[model samples]
Target: MKMDCIRTTAAGLAVTLALCSPLVAQTATETDNDRLDNAWSDIIEGEGQLLSPTQYAALNNLAFQAAAARVCDGEKLDSEAFGKAVADILVDTETELTDNEHMQRNAAVLISFGTRYGLFVAEANGDNEKDFCAVATKLKAEPGKVPLFLK
Candidate 1:
């Protein structure tokens, strides 16, 4: 009876460990950078065709710079640098936008990016979303407002 009880406890422990091992390993091994980088790279590759040549080039440049910045920020060897790179992409898209609608959309994208990763020190410090929307709305109301608003 004693031997059977010990065996049953051992079996239960083994099963529990087996079930939890993968989860533990995943949590211990995986970092936020890995997920961020993967998502950003996928977005750039999949959506590159949608952008104009100028926009694509600007975004690519920003992405490259942001990657270097993230490497400096991330402490680990496999740290993912996607989040900041995506923010840079949004900034590039914002800069490339000629129309009010596109600017507003890009601003919203930037705001979302900032909200997600706390990017763009200046914009994140200020009320970037509200400023962007206000500028966009003003530009829509008066086309002449575009230059001033951007300025």
Candidate 2:
């Protein structure tokens, strides 16, 4: 009886550890993603020169996602889609900027492009209220005037 009880306890411990392994891995991945996001945000918000190659790649990924998300009207984009977008942008022939204007200027460009291309849909209603949803509605209303790439 004693041996049986010990074996049962050991089996329970093994199952519990096995179940927790995936959760541990997931938590680590989430932490890494969050750290990357925060670092990227800080870099963009800073008032300085252009980002390094790695930084640029990360921000480019974020920008592409922001653009593609608008293109699909809030449809959930997978990581692979965002990665492809970033890769395409990286290989484009356009010159990269390395000034404080990189963030703001790029943001404006995306907004303008999206609006001009009718890729953006504003969430703002006719109320003219200055809120997030209101702004989104207004932009979407004049999809041709708002850029899906902008903030």
Candidate 3:
């Protein structure tokens, strides 16, 4: 009788663990996504206001230049490729900007930042681009749902 009881308890514990594991992983992924979203928002809001039209154009040129280089090298223009290319441009543009210009130079900067973060979050959540874009679009449309970090 005692052996049977022990077996039942063990089986129950195993079942509980199995059920909870996915939930725990999902929660962790969501938390990470939230963190990334917040970080991106902070960067944009803090630096995006001072960008001039010329600076924005410069940033676009930089991004396109990076993309061209990748194509020249025969690299696949996948999400990671574009993300890294934009990231490189963002860093360079930031350095070139004057100290008072604490802003992303162009729309590409904001879009690339969000794309990179969205790709990361989607991977973590085992989701696809469709799901990611849906969530993002919904969040963007809802006023005050997400901070006004991107233009």
Error of 1 at 46 (Å): 4.7
**Candidate 2 residues 58-123, lDDT tens each?**
343344335334444453445665556544444442456566556566565344334322311232
Tens digits of per-residue lDDT, candidate 3, 1-151, equal 5555444434432332233123322443554433344543343344432333333333333332233233223322345644554455455543466645535354545674344344344443443333333333333344241122221
List TM-scores for all candidates, in order: 0.25, 0.24, 0.22
Compose the digit string of candidate 1's lDDT tens values, residues 89-125: 5555434555786777676555433332333222213
Worst 10 residues of 1 by lDDT: 142-151
- TM value for model 2: 0.24
Residue pairs that clash (backbone atoms under 3 angstroms), model 1: 33-80
- TM-score of predicted model 1? 0.25
lDDT of 1 at 25: 22
CA lDDT scores, all candidates in order: 0.35, 0.36, 0.38
Top model by TM-score, which number? 1
Better of 2 and 3 by lDDT: 3
Ordering by TM-score: 1, 2, 3
Write down the lDDT that model 2 would get: 0.36
